[model samples]
Target: MNNPVMEQSTPRNVSRRGLITGTGSLLGSAALGGRALAATPRHGRAAAPGAAPRDASIADGAQVPALVIGSGYGGCVAALRLAEAGVDVQLVEMGMAWDTPGADGEIFANTTDPDQRSYWLRTRTKQPISNFLGFPIDRDIARYTGILDAEDFSGITVYQGRGVGGGSLVNGGMAVTPRRENFGAILPTVNSAEMYGTYYPRANTALGVAAIDPDWFETTECYQYARVGRRHAQRSGFPFVFVPDVYDWAYMKQEAAGAVPKSALAGEILYGNNHGKKSLQKTYLPRIRATGKVTVSPLHKVTTVRPASGGGYTVTLEQLDTGGATTATKEVTADRVFFAAGSVGTSKLLVALRASGALPRLNEEIGKGWGDNGNVMCGRANHLWDPTGSLQSSIPTAGIDNWAAGGAFAEVAPLPTGIETFASFYLSITRNPHRAEFSWNSGAGRVELNWQTAWKRESIDMAKSIFDKINAKEGTIYRTDLFGTYKIWGDHLTYHPLGGAVLGKATDNYGRLHGHPGLYVIDGALIPGNTSVNPFVTITALAERNIEKIIATDL
Candidate 1:
């Protein structure tokens, strides 16, 4: 059975709507025109007008126009724009493409399996790996893993994807735009309308962002999840709202017809959504590749970036799976390089590269101003109606903006599904913690993130009051400060990790390394502050905005 939704057009379908508005044919014609822009063989003759040149076939250390280290949303967008601008772009991803594993056998790239804990960073104990979410954290080399369990939780949990799509591969696939005030708080100089009004919609359109239709609630397990939210709201006397998820319904419908489950069924994600969910491996990269100039080499972890004597950068990369038979490494040169490996990877790389004197001339601000967006959480409700035989996997689709009312931190978003019966995610974009410090932990062979979170009297009061309001409503609700409980559960769960390589008057607004002209940080690390809401849309907007600047320079 085919997905009836996908096979047809709907008003909610932006492209279909665009067609009705006359823009559909325009986009269609543009795509039709782009066909001639396909990739040309390395040794072949010059390509047609829009054709992207092939860089993979080139010899070792090939010189390209742009080099993007991580193939996540940021890298993919940068590659596409640069390539379409006629720049030769090479996109390298640390994780390989996802391969569905068999029941008896295991596949290295499929972390979606129940047995793998590769998605969350966890403390390995004799007792199953326990984090705030209380889920097992498997650090398997297989399943194209990401850095799930960050050693430090005061900052953010910092979930990173290793495969072709980076965080997009394992993220909740929730595309949310930060509130106007939150966005302004971080990048004060940014014009709200320019980003939110214009760019935000464009980003959503390009990514095919849409809310899960009400039918998803009426016809599937989504309703069950909503019921859990409603019951909690009713019992606690707090309001509950539906959250929009980026999980493609059309695709999920198809997967269901084939007997594949959907994330709505308590399908534990964050480890990886085996059930059809929004993993970037299936989203942005393909169209970006279609621009013809972008080529992604999965399982290629970037090791270093050195400025070439004359121009551009020399990027070093290594294959992820040689069975560790040998750590074969390679390097290539590019006129421009974008680091989209998220905060942990990008900050670590920059800090290491600078500290090792690879780019000794980097400014003092190279690895300074690190923050985890001051995340805090307090959940209260007057209900204990935990639904059985259902998965509460999706987090908050809607949130309140009390943070603006002189409340605690920034804002609070709901935590959806979990191993336990009663748990909700509460994210705070409160007072930006005095930036965390970053250093290489040679003994651990990883970056060490250290920060001291101070409780602002007002923020704490606000947090407590927010819960108080809910408690006054109906039933019993509990308050848990994620950071306060860090000693026990190790920094409650946070999918959003930000800062490290911050942007401001200090660093170039576009996140270019202060003194290093060709180096740019396009990942979450570049975000100067955090938002109370999910940070994906904000990250995407910043990336999109930055790439536009990079291309305007034609470097």
Candidate 2:
């Protein structure tokens, strides 16, 4: 259904509860006034005063002042910032426009009782951990409006969020910014001093990030798993540190006190949080909608982007129904286009367009230098004395940072099923240098990422160094039953896929595509290989830096 662009009318600096009310309208409207575009041929025609684009028609398709693809971190930030600069902006997302409740009166499904709303476009459920003790834990479900999208490549399966808010919807809310020392290596061309001093802080404030309450964290069941990881790491003589998150600390306290329906305490991650977690839908998106100059279109996927004969560019869109089937094809024109479709999403489009001769001027570096962010998941078999609580919390607050020595940041993740299992699960982020490329496969009519399953060995080795030290200290062994019967390494997939269309290679220093003047790539696609952290903060920061430049010169 094509939704209306609704008014914001919420309080200034609204609470997350405000999202509960505006979310429906947010999706229905999509972005700002996200509705059907005008079909009139748009060539050098100025928008009539009070004539919304959704209300007018161009001869060929819709004509927009600026168009942003993907409502993820980069897109949302771009939309909000541009609108704030008095520019008309429209955002198109290829996923569900959330906000409507299902028959069960819930906005989303839980990680435990996964339903049709658990996954995106998949007949079977894909919980990150596919097995328990060599037994497959996956289930078949009717494909519907799920949140988490397990985008499968030839070699690796990437778990990303699919919806209006993008990664913010399904992630664990770990809003990590890369260390200042690592900025030079990650972005290569960006100025480190300016980013660390200005943009990073701007991104953090905009994200509403906050550290866990030290007192509550020390006592709550939510962090017992983290504490266990810390103890193990400390015993092994490794450094441990707290990780900040976008979740509301006050709300989390209420959940732990039984004052509210438990979300984090109820083992809700990967799917979505019913409350507390400050996903982008609860933050940037709402602000963008309030701007009045921004509009959003959800369930609309941008298929192609090429420079128009006159000026600006023409964008093709495929609209998908609730069943994830294409319902309609559309065309739109924009004076300026920004690509914020995450790393894989943007790379797929750029690589395909270049191969198809849609935008042959694109640089040869469009789909190169992609990595898994050194991500590895493993579970440790703990002894009877080291019982890692049955009633665990899903929100991780602490991590074992042996990055200086082992190049690893191990967050003590949880298997919170309300059952006492003597196992400790951890997801470590290491510095894996293995990079790959994405190329268009004409035979398959799709983009193929040339990442090898074996490339994650460097990450695995880094992770093993720390775990091995902990295992020696605690007399523990690796759990062979978690991933598969005898399988141990969770290297075939990654939750963090970095690179593809790297900064300073595929695009200019400030994310302006090298060959396409008005086209910009502003997502993880801009990062070379890895951010050495959770990446959302870095993505938001780089966008802030680049968009500021774009506004000053291009606008």
Candidate 3:
């Protein structure tokens, strides 16, 4: 879901490929000249053996049967299915391939020690948790195209992954599916029976979703923090559930046993996991490549999609360099286009296109029903006796489920600061009803979100329904040092940005755009806001269902 931070002003007419090449040269020259030495690898992990195969960039004036706008979950699914049906597909990603190692020799940077690879084209890192123990934790880094993108709107910062695999590369790997009873609310137009009976199982199997070894979880040193969280949840009468994840539990066990290089146990979930976690690069992209009918172009951004002079759609693209500069501009024609560039990316592009008259027939619901999935972060200060572990696993395996009773489900997140902080961290997904909209601001020449930060108050209140009671029962207070000076709620950012292009209103039941025959929205933008849990599994399953239908009938 290549979501780059929106620039306030209109972009310069520079080539994206030139910028990337210049940036890469700058980094390479610095490393060779000894001005920028790569940091030593941590956690006993070795450097990446070598670079992986590169995806060919798209040429100007090329024509394709299908153009998938993103390499995220939905785009990958669409490309694979379309290719399997003997259709030639071209997938364009706005970020780097991430197949090559950096100056550090590792494919990704560590969470504790962020480098240039930590953020997307930012001079500094904007960590989700900005503070720790009353001190700011952000640091400066070289400006190159990185993995995570903290895209800022008016009132909120939407965090998205910037590389080929999209959000899967930077996420916590919590592949959660909503409870069957709650499925109706998540996607009311979709058939729940088909989803639960077929698509859900299919998605889960493809994603390698699995539960933790409960017996080992009870006694593992790395999961001691989770155990402490469970004890507090049980004492407070909240249901503590073991959340399944996409991480390879077997590799994690090997990490714990010191038999393999540590990843999850070494706090490696934020930037990108070098091992253990099964990101889309390891899962879907490999299969998509195997089909040989789908060609992917990383660092290629789709800028416009208009009706071609002759037939099909004319797709304009900008080839970006590592430094986020445009090195080349290419125009291609596609018989069909699938918008899967995440919620923010897809919504911004659609709103701009509609307002600019490129796609004038696009419906009025283009940029409506955007949500943050009610994301809020807080920490609980525990007594010294209940130390929440010095060593913690970066992969979250448990959560406090109060969704039905309190409208909040909090994952017992890890605070892997390499020391015992005597605090328990939680990222709660509450049932926040406030949905923002993305609109084309003619004055600014950019898409703006009409989201007031105050809207998060509802989310805060819902989250309080769970933590406030826990605080009362456990006699613990909310930790104010993690967010800011005396600030308890980390409400400024959201990892799960859902909606903007809703299913029924913005698109048909099968994700076909209402007014456009060949355009489709097949990503998180299809889900209207909250999913009552992590949304990736739902997104994948929904895509599975939609693409299957499209292939059977439309294609």
lDDT of each: 0.54, 0.77, 0.83
- Let me know the TM-score candidate 2 reaches against the reference structure: 0.89
Which stretches in model 2 have alpha-carbon errors above 4 Å?
1-60
Indicate the TM-score of model 1. Answer: 0.74
Which order, best to worst by TM-score? 3, 2, 1
lDDT, model 1: 0.54
Candidate 1 structure quality by residue, lDDT tens digits, 1-555: 011112112223323222232222223222212222112112233322222222343235788877888877777777777877887777876654544333332222122233323432232211111322222323222321333434344434454565566676566666777667666777776677789877788777776677766665555543454455455444543444455567766766554455564453434454455545555554566567677777667557778888888788887777655222225678788887788887777878888888777877766665666655555555432233443212333433444445555344323332332223343435444554456667767787766766544423333455544555544443333422222321212233345667778877335877677777888888788776465566777787878888888779745
- Give the C-alpha lDDT of model 2: 0.77
Best by lDDT: 3
Give the winner by lDDT: 2 or 3: 3
CA lDDT, candidate 1, residue 373: 56
Better of 1 and 2 by lDDT: 2
- For residue 446, give model 3's deviation from the true position in Å: 0.6
- The sequence of per-residue lDDT tens digits that candidate 2 reaches over residues 1-555 is 011212122244323433332232223222211223222122223422221132221223988889999988999889988999999987888776666555554566667766667788888877667665455667777777578889888789998888788888888888787777777778777889899899999999989999988887778766676778888888777888888899888988888889998888877787877777888877787688677888777778888898888799999888777788887888889999999999999999999989999889998999999988889988776666776776787777778887777788887788776665666888889899889999988887888988888888888888887887777777666665456655677877888877888888898888998887899998888887788878889989999999999999999
